[model samples]
Target: MHRSPTAEAEVAEELAEARPDLVSRYAAELPGARAAVLTRLWRALAYEPLPWVAARVTDGDGLSLRLVDGRRLDGPPADPYATAAYVTDVRLDGRTYDDPARLMTDLGVPHSSDLAAELGHSVASLALSRAGQPTVPPKEGPGADWEWEQRVVDGHPFHPNCRSRPGFSVTEQLAYGPEHRPLVGLRTVPVPAAECLVSGGWPEGMRDGERLLIPVHPWQAAHVLKRVGDEGPVAHPLMSLRTLALSGEGPHVKTALSARLTSSVRDISVYSIGVSATLSAFAESLASRTDGLLHFTRTLGAVTADSPDLAAVLRESPQTYAGSGERVVPVAALATTDLPSSAAWLAEFTRLALTVGLRLLDLGVALEAHGQNLLVVLSATGAPLRLVYRD
Candidate 1:
């Protein structure tokens, strides 16, 4: 396997030539980004079941981890939910270090090298993400749900590789990253209707006579399929970069993006398409048992050309569940709004989410209710009312 330059080096090189004006800002935000990523890494070390960690010890000196390699790592008391960059440094084997990547490298654990590289990318990408944002968030949250999604500058809250987009260049990140707020113009590849295995109703607009047009993310087109196709609708990239919110309030398009983001390569598998209709029906049936407390966005349609590299899934947006004067917000974007500050509001939201989640769990269906998949419907007064879950 070949290795590329460090993420910070790559970003610096790109910005020096193409975005010189942002060079200083990106540099300024690096420290905070490092701290942010370090915080997540610390939390994972303290809690997650990593095989390399043989034992965990916590006492007056904060948290300590004894690695399987006979080395010990120490850090400040970990707060699983703290968003602030309170962790600036930690001690590993009596040596003080600040960079999460460097610390991982020094640990010399199995696959630590790969994880270290991702941690480095996470730090650099996170800095770039923060540099692109306004210093202060808007006093009033945007009306559109997509706008709220963009406000989540950082990616996964707990993953060490939160902002690590392994294959995306800085240019591509700025162009397709939701936090950058770019209008992504999607393209469509027409496949013979006979060759496609489709579930539900494939829209007429996405068809040309006997061919079904599959929406393709630009990244996938240039890098994976290596062929350009007809232009489709322009859309806003949501939290999941492969999924986009189409113009004219159309269904959200989940295109095949064969890039490694965080943990996995995001490609729409054919197996998923094969079972999409059944899964959607099952989810709908389960949602009906919630008595209006929970809703699952219907998977409108799914099509695959017998390849994970070329597939698409169209689903009703969570916004469709919001009634008049109410707004549907992804749980990830809740931090951008003022509702989380209120003790009463947090309690209410927690109660609503747990009720729906546990109810479905009792029925033997466990939902991946992560911040991105779980959404909340807020009343006019910013009170969390109902819960929405989607794939």
Candidate 2:
């Protein structure tokens, strides 16, 4: 039972909305595929306590009715794919209804209720699916699920949790949406150099050495305590992988965050309520959706925010040392000409740096956000997904 193109586009737009990074990264693989992704995501929720959602219909034959969510209506259709092809147009499960009861019979609430009504729920019970990863491994195969205590939620408005939520029921948090992050594993920073932030320590890892201004703002740092409590690697393996190039006109960003919250909310911003308050405000809304799903990230300089970029280089690029009182004008990293900045393909490099800086902002965790603080792994080209941490 496919819906109308407008309806499907709306759903895809919802899923692909806030996280500009996701759009930037995976737009290529999304348009033509989604039904199976939706099926896998919803089927996994069969016995869980996640919220009810409107299933997007995707089929082309007579009553190829699967539930719009995962369980479609068992009925007849004009030609199967004809009457309701909208669900696949944008490639999402119908449109998003904030009300769980309307999306699922289990919620059992009338659809006419205030659309803005807020609900609280946990993420543990929600179904997890690869909405659009290209290389989705078998659900039962090795590394089938990301297997983190965390799972993305499904809701009308996505809200990714900036803070950790321990000992919370997944079902109870579903209504709150993605704003509630499931902190089962340790989220470590990937910094390998000694810096002012962690005194040369890894941003999220345990201390290792000494550095100045190593201060990690409470806003940018996700969590630095304890290793992964599970059997997986101490940190997410994805961080160890290389990042992809920005093939888009700019950086390709795919993340889950509030569009309104995209700007820096640190003490520096006029609109910022400080890191804690900004996070709290986000949490309040997150608690409302608790769908364990809010994926939004933005791109900067339309590419990456790295030292090589003109904007980033000029603002934060390292300066070369010159003899004192020699009337010598300070030289720049590229100007030092030790390496070919020209060979660096300066244009592409700038775009890459901007992309990284912007995504980290969307994540709302502490970060130097400069080129030096970022990591770029060369591996991970065809994988379905991978974790990214700024050391």
Best by lDDT: 1
Compose the digit string of candidate 2's lDDT tens values, residues 337-380.
22223544444445544554454456664344422123221112
Clashes of 1: 0
> Across residues 166-257, which tens digit of lDDT does each residue of candidate 1 receive?
88888888999999999999989999999999998899999999999999999899999999988988999999989999976788999998
Total backbone collisions, model 2: 89
lDDT of each: 0.89, 0.24
lDDT of 2: 0.24
Give Cα distance to truth, residue 153, candidate 1, Å.
0.6
Candidate 1 pairs with clashing backbones: none
**Maximum-TM-score candidate:** 1
lDDT of model 2 at position 389: 23
Model 1: lDDT of residue 22 = 80
